[model samples]
Target: MRKLLLLILLAAGFLSVRAQDVSLTKGWKLAIGDSAQWASPTYNDQHWQAVNVAQSWEQEGHPGYDGFGWYRIHVVIPSSLKQNAFLKDSLRINLGSVDDNDEVYLNGKLIGRFGGKTGDIKTGSFYGPRTYTIAANNPAILWDKENVLAVRIFDTGGDGGIYGTNFSIGMADVMDHVTVNTEADFNYGERNSLSKSIKLITTNHYDYKGKLAFKVTDPETKAVLYEKTNDAAFSVGRPFTYSFEIARLEKKSYTIVYTFTDEKSGKEITHTETTPYLLTPYPSAKPKINGADVFGARPDHPFLYLIPATGQKPLTYKAQGLPDGLKLDAATGIITGAVAQKGSYPVTLTVSNRLGSKTKSFTIIIGDKIGLTPALGWNSWNAWGLSVDDKKVRISAKAMVDRLSAHGWAYINIDDGWEAEQRQADGKIIANSKFPDMKALTDYVHGLGLRMGIYSSPGPRTCGGFLGSWQHEDQDAQTYGDWGIDYLKYDWCSYSEVTPANPDLPALKKPYQVMRSSLDKINRDIMYSLCQYGWGKVWEWGAEVGGNSWRTTGDIQDTWRSLSSIGFNQDKAAPFSQPGHFNDPDMLVVGKVGWGPSLHNTRLTYDEQYTHISLWSLLSSPLLIGCDMGHLDRFTLNLLTNDEVLAIDQDALGKGASQYLKKEDYQIWVKELKDGGKAIGLFNLSDKYQTISLDKNDPALKGYTKFRDVWQQKYVITTGKDFSAKVAPHGVMLIRVEK
Candidate 1:
């Protein structure tokens, strides 16, 4: 009986030891100014502002002050507690959130410091809470009697405070520990109810020296599924990444628990994360065409479409079953093969990624060939600048359709500044006196067998200070659709007010999505062109946003200098253009006489103008003549109506143009056609006529022993390894060769 009583007493003593409490709510003193006297132990802080230990001084009434401030707290260690207890050595002081920067010290010994200025709207900054550790070597930081913990904070601007509420002095074991951040949150790709391999990433930030063990278990059933451990050593401030491939997971929710220990301190940290393991069946690996219509498919040509996978990094795509000689571009998803052997063929495509793979298939029924080249067009911006009006547009449309329709020009576009002052009500669009009848004008253009294009901005004001489509996307789209507008050019200028200078994808996505959805609902077939001047990688998602074309460079002016600058910029965007969508280098500036306070001011010479047209044609840009058709001189008419010059721009083979040779003042451009022929352009950018020579060994001239000068209508044969000729300043020599 006496032994039993002794056992009960021992149990009581153990319970008491476990229930012991430590109070961290004590005296905190603060000092201001340049005096270091507060560091002395004898200095009295009784007269200083008294406050709670874990509180924001700024919230309590410190005003008009944002700079360096000092905070000190005195903590007492109970005599009953042993100096070497693990609990006493594992204490930490968390200072929530500090503006700009901070440093912590225990009894004049620095513990830890984080330095940086507050975040501006442009750059991100220190957010959330910060923590500092108290090691065993500095036990005096919280001594047996009185101890002082000091903190120095610096605030440059904005609200200076320890943001968010909870601040405490607690034992490290009492707080949740994270040895590694949660990595594998959900299964990659499509989720299903089948067992599959799962990959996870583990990051180790703590200074730990031991094996890290990971285990997955069904939280509800308490059944362990997978377990693995790795021998990893991590130093403080250094992060290490570890990947684990675990298999045999079904469609169920599971909890992952990971644990690690410090070899020297014998301290262990454990983390738990929960995620769902889905087992959805994989999608079929066959090509499925989208965006095509119900008309019977043709052997020679048929419109085929497919929506590329969204949210994945862009991919290179290759397709088969196109007419024999044509080749498809895998990187751009463009079908570029020539339909030489006319017969129906089944089309199939396979898309693969690092994670997995997918496939799509369709039928291409070939028939008698129909020409699929883009329609030749004319835009008024090059001819009239901001002076385009109803009378000018109507007369030009009639003249172009009457004179150039037989030569393949089919679109007449009215560029910027078509809106009137009455539309200024509520800053929305309304046609003015110049366009008294919008529908009549559209009909007038259509009556001449031509399509009509108009322009506006995505913001509240256009570049010409006219009404834009900011808050009126749907209204403006409906208005344009009602007026029978065939194409719309949406520019981005005042839109920057709502769009931050450098914004993340999410911030810029909503505005673009709104405009796209509105246009699609208004008229799905309406051609939409986006003009954002190449900002925000708009080309990456321009097609998804309902854009048929997008401006990839700044505005082009009527000069060889401006034209060449824009021409070079087009090279970077070559990879993004496809059959329906294109990269626009602004409008053509061939006939504009200059705008700003100048009359009939011809900026580009006749040779420069020829070079501009030659480059644009070879580049396969939209053929929008900016020259005024009603007032065209004989020279301008001859340049615009040359059938041989138009053939290069209307090439059927859809291949990107290339620059074969480039010097300080000259360049050679060429495009290859599927018919074993080529179009070559030689340009001289200097002020004086210069002798130009072509090397037969160059890739551009390799297949050509003889060529016809299209403009001169004369055939020339090469005599030796090089052909030399004198070209006028800013002159271009356009030639067609049959290999």
Candidate 2:
């Protein structure tokens, strides 16, 4: 009895397998060459080359001539088979590798066609095969007895061949009998090991309703990783989104398998794909060397890069390590403390994400040392807009070095509008009358121990309509190099018009690629500052395109609102900014009085200006002063020449700017320097003088024991928990703290 039951079960499984094999793969003949009347039911091709089904013309060596070709396959249905066939049957033809494009015909009837050699598809491109389906009811398609099928192809370039794949005729006996396709298109977005999180986007085209189920699985282990079932009867065009978190897995190659099935019909289809996943351990949170103080402070604030783990999100730093006066924020990734005695201390940080957890270890070295503070520089835009002339530029350069060089002011940058038609023809770019002797001017600046910086728009025209380096990228770059131009600020103005508003990044990145390539070819050593004003997150690909610095915000005017607005937008972009390539928030608006073609001269009170500088300094922005250094007032000179304040802006570890206090009209910002010190700025925006206090207990201020006014060169020795100082309206106070 047991053997009989086993036999019955075996018989059922065998019958099921045989039933699926009934699919139409037999009784088909193919022919090559194009004929206008090949689609006619009565068409005859007795003399044409004969070929077997499921074969490509290329495989037979008679791939046919290029340009245009045709393929025909004949199928006959017997009267008995037609009567036994299920209703509403469908036949699918899979044409593999048609040079550029092709059209198909079945039983002397036009079935379907797909264009392959047109548009972005070239004759010899990485294109996949195409599949077309046709209804089986038309009499023109023929029901039985020697039916003919034909396909015409057009190839523009490269080898023209047909690499055919699966071909079949399927039937649907009931609504649930429809086949479920398990194909999905995927695109990977931004990813980083520091934030062990990656975005996986997939587009599904099959009906996932009723008994159909969609599932993602691990191919190696055959583990069901993620799965989803459609509750709604969604149509074939509906798109679904699924976000999955793959936990702590070692760096390795993995396959994502997708399966679709109609449980009611027991019909299913599965597709698998493999992608690389690299897992990197997070960098040590605390510095390895201790006893090092930043910004001339006693016990220095910790300085180090925070490496993200695979799939981890941005860290939320919390204070940790050291004595009661020291703390680090795990959420903000900031370490702060004040030390009476300088010594080395070990530091460690714990990082966690959805994937898993890891600890980073290092040490901080504290010491008393002083080095050449980074220089302050002047940029032309703030003082003179389109009105800048050759004499005006020369005069500014001389003034910056003659009066401010002793104060550590070095580079003299000639912002936009310097490329006057004198340098080149076509009015696109050239040194105009502004600087007839461009080389001489650069030489003169260098002679004064100051570097020279020039500006040009990345577009066809500069913002002032002066000469620009658009298509002439290499030529313009060579011109700058030849003229001994030390720095290049490539602005993106009219270029924005060419850039798509909502760019399909994958499609519209060619222009930027070209520009970057051209710039690198011209001069790789020249500082290439990309000024694409944050369009489509250009910074994401800026570094790859040879940009040393890219703008993270829109064009900024000199105003309290504008400064604060641009300052706040820096948080999302803070991670991408590093040494060599920095985030530029436009130029400074310090000395200028908001006059001329310049945007509103930051109507901010002195205090507000201080806040702006503090924020920019902490943010590690390129300190290219836009004010007139030639006529620097006492107050303006002091603001521009503060060595202690400038040290934070040029910290070796590259600390990011953080807001310690935020108010509508007042604010405080700070930057942790390499040493156990801090660059702090307090600003007063209102007309009335306001007294601001620094809270010792504040997490950002945790590592400071004594305060020194950097701009005034005065020290305030106080161990109190808090300290206060009065700031004049529209004025600012820049300071460094020692622990």
Best-fitting candidate, measured by TM-score?
1
Q: Each model's TM-score, in the order given?
A: 0.49, 0.46
Model 2, range 1-739, lDDT digits (tens) per residue?
0000011111111111123322334433345445678666566656656554344344345422234555555565444433444434554344433444666666555666555335422232222245554555656544546666566665432234454333433342222222222122122335411111121212334444443244544433567755655432344455333334444443333445444444444444443433333211222343222111222222432222222222235434322354445555565343444455566556555555544555544444444321112224677766666556677767887787545553345567777666655443443355666668888888777656566788876566665555567677767766776776656777654454455543466533455566556645542234566665565576577666656677766445455565766776676665665555567777777765322343222334344555666677778777777765555644456555554555567676665656667787677767666777877778666655578887788876776677887655678776567877776554567778878
**Model 1 lDDT tens row, 113-211:** 665424321111222246655654465454467776667665432234453333455444421232354422233432332222222222324455676
Worst 10 residues of 2 by lDDT: 1-10
Candidate 2 error regions (>4 Å): 1-375, 420-429, 506-513, 522-524, 538-541, 593-603, 661-666, 682-695, 725-733
lDDT on C-alpha atoms for all candidate structures: 0.57, 0.52
Error of 1 at 172 (Å): 80
